[model samples]
Target: MVKMGVEEGEVMQHSMLTKSIERAQRKVEENNFGIRKRLLEYDDVMNSQRTVIYSKRKNALFGERLDVDLNNMIFDVAEEIVAEAKEQGNFEDFQIEVIRIFAITPEITAEEFAQGKIEGLTDRLFEQAINAYHHKIDAIGALTVPVLNNVYAERGQIVENVVIPFTDGIRGIQVSANLKKAIETNGKEVFKSFEKGIVLALIDEAWKEHLREMDDLKQSVQNAVYEQKDPIIIYKMEAFNLFKSMLAAMNKDVVSFIFKGEIPGQETTSLQARQVNQAPVKTIETKAELVSPTGVSEEDVNDGPKEPVRNENTVGRNDECPCGSGKKYKN
Candidate 1:
């Protein structure tokens, strides 16, 4: 049921086709076939990457081994941070990024990591991140139910006052205080739901960003041909690097937002589509006439025996003037 674009229902007809007609229609123009072959070549490259992302999304949606997935996300974040720090030859900026986003202070420093020969750097970072998370959970204890219920109650009251129209067929429901109290009483399950939401939201945001960058690269990579470079080769290399960066970003964003008690919103990563509609067109009319060397009018020439050649015979300076009103040819 997936379609490239919406189609009018009137045009969506399925007709019975005979075997003979089907075979005859298979004879495509060579040029068109070649064009499609080239198109698929580029599409194959993107398809492979798209498959991996979609698989990940399916897993998240189906709640498959979610706890293990969360653990992997944490490790991924740790590894990415360590890798970046290693590349930059310093951890000051790394620490700053982590602190600013996740609100966690790592006791380990870049200088210290260098001193330790970079051993167990990832483990140390993960431990610090986990500790920060656990501390937040402990702080929310006992008062978690009461706090969540109060927030949900306020939201329910607002929903009762505001009239929201139904979309398609279904209308969104506001979180009621009773539902919130039930969730709070359910204990760890409620928080697990929150964590899952955060992770999926971050993954979606990061993937969208990666797709946007890839699209931009696809559009502009042709400029490489001016330098006698292969655009496909350049695209593949850049895409690989971009995918790696996307994974790292997803890992970092998920963990950071979860620890910060926030969900990544559309405002964080949404991109506006640029429209290039055709400009308005205007048409103008003008009249043109040809004057013959014999001083013949355009209408007279058209009405003559045949079309007159404008420059067939030249008027020499010593010849009589072709125009009857002229005094001399050179005058």
Candidate 2:
């Protein structure tokens, strides 16, 4: 009877130990699962943003109706400018913005702006913007077609592609087009290339920078936990705002570049070459010497020898002489 009781006690103890370990294992697994789920939630946010940016890039890259895309951008820019001007109650600023963005002066007068009946102003500006863009394309085509033809005549059999340079004041890219096709299409093909190149370039740059910002934002928002805030919520809100701002800026840049870009002419090319060749202005750094109230310059005071400070007991004139030639008094 005693041996049976001992065996039963040992088995019960072993069972309890095994159950404890199992419970701990399950708890650890639950913790790991929660961590993975949270990580996935964070990644989901970036995935959505990635999807949006990639979709835009795809459309710009492969879509047949790029002009329609450009037109929509112009209309949006016009609307934003008008909205801003209305908020500021300044029509002069409106005209300035129009000229800056579209490179064309606005015909809408200040009085018309003041009357607050500018509902059709956005549409009007859109039309003007479209016209200006077409005019720019025509001008560029006129300038380049003769040169293109000359090149084609010389190397029609050997040359299949021509490189065209496009610049947006800040950056330049070379776009290649089928030389024969450019001539056949009367430079329409080149224009399309320009549109696609500009859109893709700006989108790529903006999206890349936005991704960097998001990475930084994700790290920074982790500190929100110290403030008893949900880091994910903060990240979502801030990320949305950043994405919107980036998108707006990218759209504006695309529209501005398209509207303002031009094929470099001989004079313009020479001017650019000259500017590049010119020496950079030498900035002379002059250090200003600070003068003390006593008229000693700070440099002189600092560079000159520092006097040793005396902390010896003061010798009264009547009490006599620390010089060790001491008489008891004033000699």
Candidate 3:
């Protein structure tokens, strides 16, 4: 070893313990660096996923072509339906699925489906599904636009932007759109906001869950080293799988919510109005009226005869009688 303060050409001898300690220190540093490098590689995987998710969220939040996105999703779902049915060679199942998802019966008959090519079937179903969805929106607009106009006329206010309520049974979100645009598009413009809200909500929820899963995965993958496997490689592969599964689930949920979601319609509004108009109004009781002359509230007094309380230590069915009968309690 060469001492820092030694002159040129001078060498200092160190004990064996000192050399061993220096080697251990260097080894510890290398181990730490390796750990850090592994961590960086893991984070790189997450960074890529984060970038993808945030990009989607941004598009949903501010993009102008959300209808195009929705159309693509609709087509993808339609394609999936057709492909599954084709794989199973079941036209009945295909028709059922189309009705279930799109609320429209397929125009193609069983024979036509049996003879149609996969690409042709997919395209045909996509066209039908998209058209049905548009018609459904137009029908809703037919109901909603009149109601909106009525309200605006009564209020004597100009219509600009309007907030529409959409629900997926469990979750409800309010989406805003330009009334003029919605009217021009026959309620398709309002659905753009619907798609935007649904996409954003699903993305946020799925991304949060994905993060938690990734955290668990990170901790769990640490044990891979004990199995004589490279932890980083396992983590990367598993993380990619997890990400793909997450994306698939998110997309499915978005499509399902969009198709199955309920918008408040004229019938619902009228039913609510009738219910409100017919509901009986009850008068609130005053505190003095609630109290009896005995200074106790009528509700506090039970009018019925009280039942006797049973003792907790009552004889069990198998216990000997307390009357000295030397028989079981049941007997």
Candidate 4:
């Protein structure tokens, strides 16, 4: 029984020692993991710092060169501005516009340029950009003018439009205005001409009708003056004035219608309408005075005479001059 007890106690002590060894080994493993993690972290920081230093150095060295390259490509400036990004390694912004400026400087650099898969046009455009900076603009612009009026006209005339451009301080200023843009008379020009014709005809017709109406009125006044041959010459002068105005209004297109206002030795029938329409004129008229008038009856006629008036002044011309005065020149 004592020997058995001794073996059991020894087993317990051995087991405790094994557990302590395992715990120490676990602590060592945890410390190793921490050291490895810190080393990896340090390596990551060094790599990041190396990348930043390299980028900043690259930009500082080629920074001005990149700008020069862009200026040579775009012909925009002698000392152009080139952009740089902090995150994307080196020469990224410089490379962007460089592909447009010159052929890939593959021979100049030990490494192949990145843009090997872009289109051919992109390369050509970039090359042209660089080439443009090398030379002056000598390109001649082109224009086309369509022939108007059957490509030619025997006697037709044409006018042209002009363009003016301002070139105070620009690198290139082109006066690009059509000298004489050809517009066919069969086109909108013809339509505009036709429109003007229609408007003129309308004006002419309006004035024509108006004048003819006025002419008719003047002729009537002239006839009235002729019938009043026994009246004062002032009325005939008025009739002449009306007739003159009739001719003026009738021929306004050919004449200016400027009134000299001088009736002259021979009177004019111009003032008849104005004067006739203005005042009143009186004449001796009775039923007996117009009954036998058949030579020409201007006014409406009556067929029969009603009667005549008898007066005590029915004396001879030598007797008081038939004016009812008791005196005569020979009495």
lDDT of 1 by residue, 1-331 (tens): 3374645663443455465556666665666797788668678878998897777676667767776776788877777767777778776877886686568888886567776544388788778877777776555333344434443454534221111111111211111122333334543433455555556666787888888898898888889999999888888898889988787777766666566663123311211111111232221111112445677767775784875678778888977899986667998
Error of 4 at 157 (Å): 73
For model 1, the stretches where C-alpha displacement exceeds 4 angstroms are: 1-28, 87-91, 109-111, 147-186, 262-331
lDDT of 4 by residue, 112-196 (tens): 2233222332444345444542331111111112222222242123213221221212121112122223242223322222222
Q: Worst lDDT window (10 residues) for model 2?
A: 270-279
lDDT against the true structure, per candidate, is: 0.60, 0.77, 0.76, 0.34
Model 2 C-alpha lDDT per residue in residues 308-330, reported as the tens digit of each score: 99898776768867677768657
Candidate with more favorable, higher TM-score: 1 or 4: 1
Q: In model 1, which residue pairs have backbone atoms overlapping below 3 Å?
A: none
> Candidate 4's C-alpha lDDT?
0.34
Model 3 stretches with alpha carbons more than 4 Å out: 1-18, 154-161, 168-171, 178-186, 266-331
Q: Give the top-scoring candidate (TM-score).
A: 2
Clash count for each candidate, listed in order shown? 0, 0, 0, 13
Instruction: Give TM per candidate.
Output: 0.55, 0.73, 0.67, 0.16
lDDT digits (tens) for residues 12-75 of candidate 3:
5679868998999999999999989988999899999999888788888997556676677777
lDDT of candidate model 3 versus the reference:
0.76
Give Cα distance to truth, residue 268, candidate 1, Å: 24
